[model samples]
Target chain A: MVSEADSDEALMELVKSRDQDAYARLLDRHMGSIYAYIYRMCQHHNDADDLTQETFLRLWSRAATWKSGQVQLTTWLHRIAHNVCVDTFRRRGPDDYAEIDPDTVAVTDDVPDDDRRRAVHNAIANLPERQRTALVLCQLHGWSNKDAAEVLSVSVDALESLVARARRTLKRELSAYQREICT
Target chain B: MTADEFADLLDCYGTDSVAWPSSLRNEAVRYAQVSDEGRRLLAKSIAFDAMLADSTHVPVAFRLRARILERIATNESPAWWSWITQSMWRPALLAILPLVLGFVIGDMTSELDGDSTDASMFLAFTDLENFVELNESTATDD
Candidate 1:
């Protein structure tokens, strides 16, 4: 009886042995966060879907290579997702990043909230890519600076600098949006 | 914590001291409570945290999760085959080794015995049916 109490490492040991049930449980446990992280990074529903799958597929294929305690499984998975997003971002033209990404296909409880969501989208999208990534990983996703830094392949100090700059940019952008809305 | 350190923590870890590294959390929270700058930064962090919490999280759609799981299941079968092909050599060699060792040891043991009945023992080197006929004829003569 594989319950939610099974540590990710335990599930992963089963996963390495090709236990589909265990893998499914792992997917159920993590798919939301992995998908959410990828979606927020790309702001495209289909791309996020594909990238999320790609991330898990990598997990399944590379299961044997995983070492316990070297890094947390979630951190490892997030790093894979990060790499997928970065590859995708690299393939896209720099000019493509300038425009507001279509509001994330994040399911909203209220239809009226779409406009505010788009405003948030534009605010995040307008920031420089690295800064935006640093913000998304640490601020929105609640990752520790060290883990987030590891994912970004940056020093913790550098990640801190990027997040500070990103926050300053997002604040200005959001304030501008608020002013425009009020006037 | 100094004002700069407090601000840095807020910048790097956002509003939640709970989410901050354990070593820094207590001091950072204490500083946030006592210092004006820390409080202001906490307010900003609070706003950001609220904004994030209120924002919609895009769940992995049901169909997408099913699709990925399905693919992984299908994908693993080939991997099992690949693993066998990649690792079978050692086992295969090990399987043949016992036979080779038996023949070598059988030859040495028979040589050590040096009995006239050794004719039967060396049967491996001779034609099997002829050896059988020779043994039958020798037995009849005896």
Candidate 2:
């Protein structure tokens, strides 16, 4: 059976030409993944929904400037989501939530798991902005390190270093959990 | 690589979105052979990465696919402005320019004609002086 990914390139071509049908088709195809990614990144349903809409608005507005093969349109959307999340972070201020334990906070869409997932997410949330972004792109999203690096505008080696540091910090923070669960 | 170095690398292994290099694979295998502890660390890292990979959660409301598509459809369609700004503006400017030039040229020519009329009247007085000089010379000659 034909897949959505195959048609995405064609839809993008239509989008570039301002073909509303194609753009609509593109949205239909990719909106779920886009929304999911944004939701995960923001961990706020309202913000994710709003940011997803904003992301598409930007995609539509910049459609004319979109050049195929520069980046996958999905990656482009993620980059937009990344910026929106960062903007939200700045607007909400550094004191958005000080002294909160990442381990205790639950940001699930449905049934709540224990604090393990919460801890992972908290570790993600507490990361320095770039490391958090890099971790989200690489770890949470399952994007190739190269693709994540491309989205972040960093060399692969630099990206590796960021991931290393982020992981080390997470390992330290969640070490207690690891000992309980793994060892 | 030492145990500490292997542990650090394992911690970083699954965290990056980038593909693991073949060289890294070799390193992992080499480390695995040198120390069972390293292999065990790699197993833990891989398990953690798998958990992250499996953590995608799409919201049910995100099925606003229809609405999203409709938004893209209605909003991005080529509109009146595209043609008005991109296609029509320059030609419209070109078309209006000659009419503006015609009005300007007409005003300038009218002013020049008025000035020419004044200069011609002044030249007519000079012609009268020449005629009077001719008559005085003829009377003297007679």
Candidate 3:
């Protein structure tokens, strides 16, 4: 049995050797976080589920690429998940809930409280693919700028810039929404 | 140091102090306490964080895990290429087997030259030396 104390590096080594037990342990360890991150990025439960499975399936085929001391296994998995999301979006359009960066947050007369939450989600979803990815990994998932940059395959400065642009967009949209709500 | 710069950090990083770059957090906090604009901007950012916090907790179905595990169980083994890697010595040896056999045969032919009437007969690669001699007769004729 692959124990909880066993490092992901150790588990991955065993996985490389065709150990079923090690693969299962790794699946159990990472599935939750991977699912959540994918779920947030894609915003569809079924797609998230498929993406999560695909991510691990990818790990099996691509296990040799993961070198220890270079990145945390979790970060590598997220990178896979990120690619899956980008590919999915490229294939199909954005989820309806978050179609575009909703510059105006259309509110005429009736303002239900739910609109704020929806607007935030749409704002998150509508971010350009890379910016959305950077925001999800760094903001929602709590990855550092460096780790997030490594996963995104960009320099830290580029990542910081994506994050800055994403936040600025969100801040501008939400600020407008806040003004609309108050007045 | 400036409220505008700190506000940008707040916009990028949100309300969480941990999210802010460590070098700037102290200066940011100091600025927030002293600057009216800093405090006001943080309050707005906090509202955004609050809104995000509500919806991010998407609970995945527990059964989803079982499906993933089952898929893993169905095809549970290293890739075909891995076998070539794990027992790499086997292929390495296989590659040199022809060379090793040639050297052994050469050594044996020279050493056993006087012992055998026909060097080609003994030198032919087959377990049954007589069959090798017969096969070589045809090979040499060709």
Candidate 4:
């Protein structure tokens, strides 16, 4: 049995050699998270799909030049995904980000009760883009402040500020419920 | 404690500050223990954290998984085939087509020229004259 790390390196080697199995495995391992990330960023499924394909096509084309470095492959992929999302936002006029479907936006199932999780998910949807990405990376995805900063290409202090501002914003946004719930 | 003071505590609450002034920790604790408002705020913050902790997840759609994999497979199959074909045949083609077309056209013109013996050349000139006459007469008839 191959360890995941070993498998990842092997798959990357295969990917560099244009192996379909490797590409499929890589996609299988990451598609859901990648899709969710892109979906959150773009707020549209079709657009996410398009961006996902474009991301992979880029990876496929550039596979030959991929260097083994300090950054993990996941982080590399996230950077590419981030750039793709940014390009999409640039191409689509600022006002053209489609409104997220309530059902899709609130599809989280992390909480014991799905309904409550959905509520929190909806609240997350209201966060500004930087805050949303920071929150998703640090709070939801369990990334360390340093790791999240690396993924965002921000300073650790900057990421800390993003998370801090995000938490305060969330607190204020949910202040109405503070009285009833905390009472 | 004033909200400003309490807010500062909240910001530093998660940090591992070895240098966190003992005075600040005591003040925050005293506030949490005695002030109803502070207790309420702490509980609210805890709930907020829990909501975040318990909320986000990547929902895996099996159909979408299959579809993406299928797309990758289809895309790669064509590329793989092209790669294989290019590897096996491209050099051979590069070496062969120009020579082959050159040979074929050369052979064809040579055969035509060979077939044009003196007698046949004369026949060709007569045929051209006949074709011109026939076209002129047809135009006149029209």
Candidate 5:
């Protein structure tokens, strides 16, 4: 019975020893974030759910592989989630991704906020995979640029570039909505 | 910071001033405070950021925790012996077993044959000694 106050590293230590309670704790701590991250990436609840489970399963099985001093657990988990998404993308092929056209988004002021948000969601889901990932990590998830870069396996500069490009696209796509909301 | 520089910072680091690089944060805030265009861009960024944040309401993964816990419960790590028994090397060792046994058996048989060969050589040497002794005795008698 690991205490609730145990650090992620401490929980991971117990998980490495096949402690199910520690595994459960880590799951509760990370599963939502990982699931959301995957959901944002893949945009399919079923796939995101499966991928999140897969990510945690890897955490449970590969607990010993984690180097506590070298990398934070959240970064490591996100990295795993990133890889899982990549694998899914590879298997599903490029055509499976339903990229929503920016022009098709209802940018009119008369559109309801929910519809505008849906447009925003489609716009994000339609961004190039790397750009979307960078934006999701840095902007949506509130991860530091450096940490997000680590998860994306790119330099901080490259990650920043991805994020910048994503924001530019989003701003362009959502400019009308931005005006409407800001007014 | 110039308008383009300020917008770039917002684009890269986001609307949150705190999330901006420390060196740029104060300058960006100052620029937003002083410049009309900067303020407009900042406001737009803030609004866009709010939209982006609110765009996707991630629903709580229904029963995901229970499903994951169930999986963890079912998929216990294999024991140490299972690591060996489940490995490719198991088949490889099985394939080499006959050769290893043959080598050992052949070595034992060779050792037995070597002893017999040594005995035969000793018998042949003894026969030669006996023949020499008989010949010498016959010669002595002659």
Candidate 6:
């Protein structure tokens, strides 16, 4: 019986041994963030759901392959989720990611009143795939540049460059909206 | 850090000084304070960061967690395989038992005196011939 107090590595050790309870606990610990990341990346609820499930399923099946100290569990999970989302994008083709209209973009009811946030969300959605991933991982998901770089399999400098370009684009796109909000 | 460097930091790390590389955070904060352009850039970065931080939170499907857990449950191996994996020593011991038995029999045979060994060897060969003869007789009868 693993307690909630167990570190992710400890739970993963048990998961490696086919411990369902430990696997369930790991799922509970990480499911939300992983789901949010997939949702943000793919921008479709159903696809995000399926991709998130696939990511965790891989975790369950590939638990033994995870080396404890080589990478943080969250970072490893993000890498898997990233790969799953990338595979989905490849299958769906680049044409599938149409521009997201701010008005039609689905968000929770709590944020409908914040036009600035919606605009920012739309701007992020419009970013090129790599830029969006870099920005989302660093800015929204709160991953450090190093960890985000590892997830993307890029150098830290390259990750920073991606994030810089993304921020510049967002700032340019949202300048008018920001001015309006200021007024 | 120069104002340009400070702005670059803002570009990569957003407006949060806490997220900036520790070695540069103090210099970046100092530049933002002393330079008008740095202040302007910092303010802009802060506003953008706030918008991003406040962006829509997409709720996971209410049943998604339960659905994943259920799928995992159904995907589990059969109980017997689960038992085998869970108690790996059982299979490992079973695997080595044959080799252990062979070694024990060889050890016993090696301990036999020379006369006793010859007699036992003769008895073994005779039993083998009898076994072959019985099989041949059975075939003739058939």
lDDT of 3 by residue, B38-123 (tens): 88777777666665666466776567767877787786664664665545465797899999999999988777676574655667
- Please tell me what DockQ candidate 2 reaches: 0.30
Off by over 4 Å in 3: A1-5, A93-98, A101-104, A107-113, A176-183, B77-81, B85-142
Q: What number of clashing residue pairs does each candidate have, in the order they appear?
A: 0, 5, 0, 0, 0, 0
How much is the lDDT of residue A101 in candidate 6?
A: 69
lDDT of each: 0.76, 0.70, 0.78, 0.66, 0.86, 0.82
Model 4, span A1-183: residue lDDT tens: 868655766788788777877887887777766777776665556777777777777666566556666677777777788888877776866576444345533323332355554455556666667777777776656567777788789997787778778778766654443333444
lDDT digits (tens) for residues A100-174 of candidate 6: 564543333333446665677678777888898998899889888999999999999999999999988887777
- The 10-residue segment with the lowest total lDDT in model 1 chain A: A102-111
Q: Put down candidate 5 lDDT per residue, B1-142, tens digits, no spaces.
A: 8999998998998888888898888888899999999999988888888888887778779998999899988867565643455445778989999999999999989887997879889999999999999999999999
lDDT of 3 by residue, A21-43 (tens): 88888888899889988888877
**RMSD of candidates 1 onward, in order:** 10.6, 7.8, 9.4, 13.4, 6.4, 11.1
How well does candidate 4 match the true structure in TM-score terms?
0.60
Candidate 1, superposed: residue stretches over 4 Å from native: A1-5, A100-113, A177-183, B1-9, B18-41, B84-142
- Model 6 over residues B1-142: C-alpha lDDT tens digits? 7767887889988777888898998888888899898988888777767666766477756788888888888998875665555564667979999999999998887776578888989999999999999999999999
Candidate number that wins on lDDT, 2 or 5: 5
Candidate 1: tens digits of C-alpha lDDT, residues A105-173:
233444445566676777776777788778888877877788888888889989989998887676655
Off by over 4 Å in 2: A1-6, A102-112, B15-18, B50-58, B73-78, B83-142
Greater-TM-score candidate between 1 and 4: 1
Structural similarity to truth (TM-score) of each candidate? 0.67, 0.72, 0.73, 0.60, 0.81, 0.73
Query: Candidate 5: lDDT over CA atoms?
Result: 0.86
Q: Tell me the TM-score of model 3.
A: 0.73
Q: TM-score, B chain, candidate 5?
A: 0.57
User: In candidate 5, which residue pairs get closer than 3 Å at backbone N, Cα or C atoms, i.e. clash?
Assistant: none
lDDT (Cα, tens digit) per residue for candidate 1, span B24-46? 98888788889888887677667
